[model samples]
Every structure is written in structure tokens, then in C-alpha cells.
Target chain A: MQMTWREIVTAVHGMLFGGFFLMACFGVLVLLHRSLAAHGGSEVKEHGRRRERIFLILMVLLGWAAVLSGAYVVYPWYRAAVPPGVTNLEMYPQRLLMSDPHTAGWHTLGMEWKEHVAWMAPMLMTMVAWVMMKYEDGSEEHRRLRAMVGGFALAAFLAGGVAAEFGAWINKKAPVTGGRVITLSQDGK
Target chain B: MSSPREAVANGAAGAAVLAASLGCFALGVLAVAGDGWKAVAGLLTFYRPTGPLSGVSTVAILVWLATWFTGNRLWRGKTVALGKVSVAAFVLLALGLLLTFPPFEDLLLGK
Candidate 1:
């Protein structure tokens, strides 16, 4: 297997960090919902509260990593300026997409929305994690708090889902290619 | 089966929810502003490599954190009207989601 630094970073951003974060969002959302029940999942709560807290912390971290990598590392390469007289725009993913009327919408709609909207997840999730950490005991059944947390979490999920979907499609149409190639394995024949 | 009158104050949690929604709303507003106006776009280009995204996200995060800090401080021990706060939050969150869509942004900008 072989891949460029850009491709690898992009995969790590969209696949690893983003993928795990999405799963974690679902997990935390379920946990929050389950707690809204009568017992607060006390059996699970006893052992799982700490586990849930740790998961939440990790989720927030992954959310940050995904967006930061997407914006700072991969996006710079994706949007790199194509020098004049450069006939081939392969290295410039944004320009490559823009050059074609058919593919321009990917850049305009997919990328534009993803870049901004993806950010909301981490911000909201961080707050969700914080509130859960401080106030998530099973004692009071804080229904109002639980409902709001669930709402915020669901919003974050939708935002991440949008970003991930667009990112996958945009990359499929006009992949962010180039950078130093790394050989994963030589011909083992 | 907790008490009819709960113990913990809802203030801190309420602050967090409110601030997060406000931050989201700010991001939407800033993103639209950046897209609609050349001057705003240039000003928001904090990092050349990342374009305007760098500033938009950074400023929105700052708004979130600052509002969170202020809200936390002001409403730490006391209870808040979370019912009202939650309604506002959902509205803002929905608006944020909508504003990020390019078609919606363009419609509002008359593009």
C-alpha cells in the first residue's frame, strides 16, 4: 500500500478522528438518554459514570483533532494556490474542482459548508462534556438539563454527519492529492 | 426516584448550554459575513493557508469560552430559568445549522 502525506493526514482527520468522534457522539447521546429513565441506569451508572466521563473527554479531544487537522493540515493543501501557467491542477484540489463546471458545486457547496459547520460539534460537545462531568449525578433526575444536553448532542451529531458526508463526497470527486509518497510495503512477491 | 425539589442549581449547566448555542450562532453569522463581503473575508483570513476559516472558528470559540466564563461566574450558585434558556438555545442552534448551508447563505446575501 502507498499514500502521500496529504492523503494520509486527510484519512486520519476524516476517518480516524472524525469516525471515532462520531461513534462517541452516538455513545454519549445514548448514555444521556438512558439516564433520563427512572433509575439513571444505576447499575451502569455505578461503574459507567467514570467510564462515560473518560469517553466524553476523549470525544471532545477527538472532535478538536478532527477539525484542527482538517483545517490546518489538510485544508491548506486542498486549497493551495495553483501557480500561473500550471496546466495541471492535480495538486490543487480546490482549483481542480472549480475548473470543471460539473465539479464546482463540490467545492462551493460541500467544502464551504463543511469547513464552517464542522466546527460547531467540538464547541457544543465540549460544553456537553463539561456539564455532564459536573452535573451528571443520578440523584436529582435533572430532566431539563438532560433534555438540553440531548438536544445539543443531537445537533452536534447532525453537524458532524454533514461535514463527514460532504467531505467524503468531495474527496471522491476531487481528492486532495500530492505530497511525499510513502511506500507502505514493497512488492512482496 | 429523586426528591420532588432537586438539590443542584441549574445555573452552571444553563450557562454552558446558552453559551454553546450563542457560539454556534456567532459562527454562522461570521461565516455568512465572510462569504458575502470581500472586506470581511480578507479580515477573517487569519491564516493564509486555512483562509477565512482560521479566524471564523477561532473567534467563535473565543465567543463561546468568554460567554461561558462570564455566565458561569454570574450564575454559578444561583438557579437559572433554563426553560426559557433552552428554547432560545434550540432556536439559535437551528439558525446556526441553517446559516452554514451555502444556498441559505446565498439567499440571504442575495447572491
Candidate 2:
């Protein structure tokens, strides 16, 4: 089977995006390790290590999400281009695609949003964790505020990503003309 | 028994390595953009992945590995500076990745 330009473009985009996201995830893991080492000592007396672990886990999970989304964006194009009978048809319908340019653009935007949030979430949590360590004598209100901010940021980032992915999926599945061709020629030329 | 001062120096060195890695990653991104699949294929598998951003990811992985090594060394030494630098590098790496996304790239290039 021949590869369409669209499929080729999408595949290239997906691979680059996926590779970057994977790097980001790896970076997050590095950061998580550093944060835990640096500030794991200062968490609340009863919940210190647990809190740090939770944040670390969250960072790691965010990395996985980015990687997964990146894969979703690219794998469809690969499958589409694969020769029939060489690959399973069951996989093709399950592949992700944005039916229109607008949807594709939005989904691309969504991936960016997800990546930014995933990056920020760990940094923010690391800051909060550091602060908790420094202000061991600080009030509960301050700690609560830090947690609230970090949690909110994470939620917002995740929501934006989910929305983008959903939008892309819906757009791809939207009913539309499957095949139509148009050509223009100068009169009597 | 490495002194605290020595640890700090080592941490700084590690941070520098990570910074360099990030720069390389950025360069790879740009190369992918300018040259497309050929650039990516050169960086990733030998099979020659096609398109502008094709194998640009392979270069990214290398950079990430370098950063991880530096950060890991610094963490082992318990240097707060190294930890901070690692976090900063990670943030930059993430930002760079986001910037390479098609939407952002289009906006930058007015595509």
C-alpha cells in the first residue's frame, strides 16, 4: 500500500513529539529523584516520606501520559501506511486521527499543554517540598496553601490534555464525506 | 571523604554537563525542523526514518541520558545545587519539547 502525504506527515510529527515527550519523562524522573533526595527529609513528621513519594509518583505518571499521547498521535499513521494483510485491521480503526485540520491543530495544541503542565507539576511540587523542609516551624495554613497550589496546577494541566485528546477523537469520528476529488482548469486550455 | 565545598564543585560540574545536553537537544530539534526526515533518520535508527522530525527523538534520548547521568551523580553526592540545576534543566527540556510541537512550530515559523 502507498503512504498518503497526510499519513507521512502525521507519522513524522508523532515520532518527533513522542521522542520529545519521552525525554521530558526521563527529565521528570531525574528531577523526582533529586527532589526526593534533597527534600524528603523535611516532609511532615507523620506523612513526610509518603507525601514526597506521592509527588514523585505523580511526576512519573505525567511523563508516561505524555509518552502515551505522543504514541497515540503517531501510531495511527504508521498503521494506515502498512500494507493490508501485513497488519491487523483490528488495529486500524482503533488508531487515532483528527478528521479535520482544525481538530488536528487543537490536538497538537493539547499535547503542548499537557507537556507544559507535566513539566511544571514536578517543579512546583519540588518547590513546595523544599519549602516544607525549610519551614519546618511554619504554620499548617502555609503548607495547605502550597499543597492547594500544586494540586490545582496539576489538575488544570491534566484537564487540558484530556480535553484536547477527546476533541481529536471526536473530530476524527465525526461523519463526513470519505472521498471526493476536485480539479480546476483554464477554459479551453 | 569529600568536603562540602568539593561536593558543591562537583555538583556545579554536573549541572554544566546537563546544560550542555539540553543545548544539544535544542540543536537537534532545530536540525529536525530545518532538514526534516533526513536529520531525524541520521539521529535515530540507521534505517532512515522519513520526514522533518522523523528521528529527531533519538538525539533527544541521548541528551536525556547525559542529563540523567550528571543528575544521578550529583544526587548521590547530596548536593542541593546539583538537584536545583537538574530540576532547572528538566524544566528547560520540557519547554523545548513543547516548543517543538507542530502548533508552536507553526506559530513561530508562521506556517
Per residue, candidate 1 scores C-alpha lDDT tens digits across A33-112 of 88776464464545677887789899999999999999999999999998888989888989999999999999999999
Q: List TM-scores of chain B, every candidate.
A: 0.92, 0.49
Best by lDDT: 1
Residue A40's lDDT in candidate 2: 41
- Model 2 chain A weakest 10-residue run by lDDT: A174-183
Clashes of 1: 0
Compute the DockQ of candidate 2: 0.05
Which structure among the candidates has the greatest TM-score?
1
State, as a TM-score between 0 and 1, how close model 2 is to the true structure.
Answer: 0.43
Tens-digit lDDT track of model 2 for A71-143 = 3444333324435555433324322333456544434554333433233323333333333333333344333
